[model samples]
Target: MPTPAGADAARRYPVDPNSRLNVRSGPGTNYQLVRVLPYGASVPVNCQKPGETITGTYGTTDLWDNIANGQYVSDAFVYTGSDGYIAVRCS
Candidate 1:
């Protein structure tokens, strides 16, 4: 799959240290389950988009982070330092 622009430059962030996060096919839970991230996994968020609001270890938000092509994880489970978009918005 083609990687998003700036993906190589994307900064890696820690997932919720205490939980294994779900990777979805889209930006919401309604989407298919793509994979399950391992505990203590750090991911590079390529982009972000608005999705179903989720309350996770970090905080509640509607942001879903694109870690790879067709791979998304709830931002509430990722620590990007701020409770806001840190990367480019997904197209």
Candidate 2:
């Protein structure tokens, strides 16, 4: 699949060390599940969009990061340091 332009170099966020994070087909839990990201699995956040709110170990947030062409993960399940590094919005 064609990747999002320049997304690979965006700041990387590893799934939070506490648990496996869901990688979904879209930004919300209602979307199909794409994969499961184990702790320490890091990926660049290509962009972000508003999604279902998820209260993960890190905190609660309604943001989702598009890490790949059709893959998204809840922002609450990833760690990009304090105050997530803002990324471009996906088209």
Candidate 3:
């Protein structure tokens, strides 16, 4: 799907049970570790702040596989890769 217009577009990330993702310091796995998010968590794809990188595993590479947010729930998505994005479980 095409990205929406404006800053909100950048904040939004694709969410799917099969969509691989990583929980890191920044949006990409290149940063420090925070945790590994599994499937079933309420990922907040459209609520990231500016300049704050939502760290996560590569989702598609060995470097990413090393990172682990923790465990998977029922309402979580499986991060795949760059195509996949960072997400946070909602309360």
TM per candidate? 0.89, 0.82, 0.31
Number of the predicted model whose TM-score against the real structure is largest: 1
Candidate 2 segments exceeding 4 Å error? 1-10, 82-85
lDDT of 1 by residue, 1-91 (tens): 9999866656699999999899999999999999999999999988899999999999999999999999999999999998998888999
Candidate 2 vs candidate 3, lDDT winner: 2
Better model by TM-score, 2 or 3?
A: 2
Q: Candidate 3 on 41-91: residue-level lDDT in tens?
A: 334243222232233332232212212233221112323334332443222
For each candidate in the order shown, give its overall lDDT on alpha carbons: 0.93, 0.83, 0.35
Which of the predicted structures, 1 or 2, would earn the higher TM-score when compared with the native? Answer: 1
Best by lDDT: 1
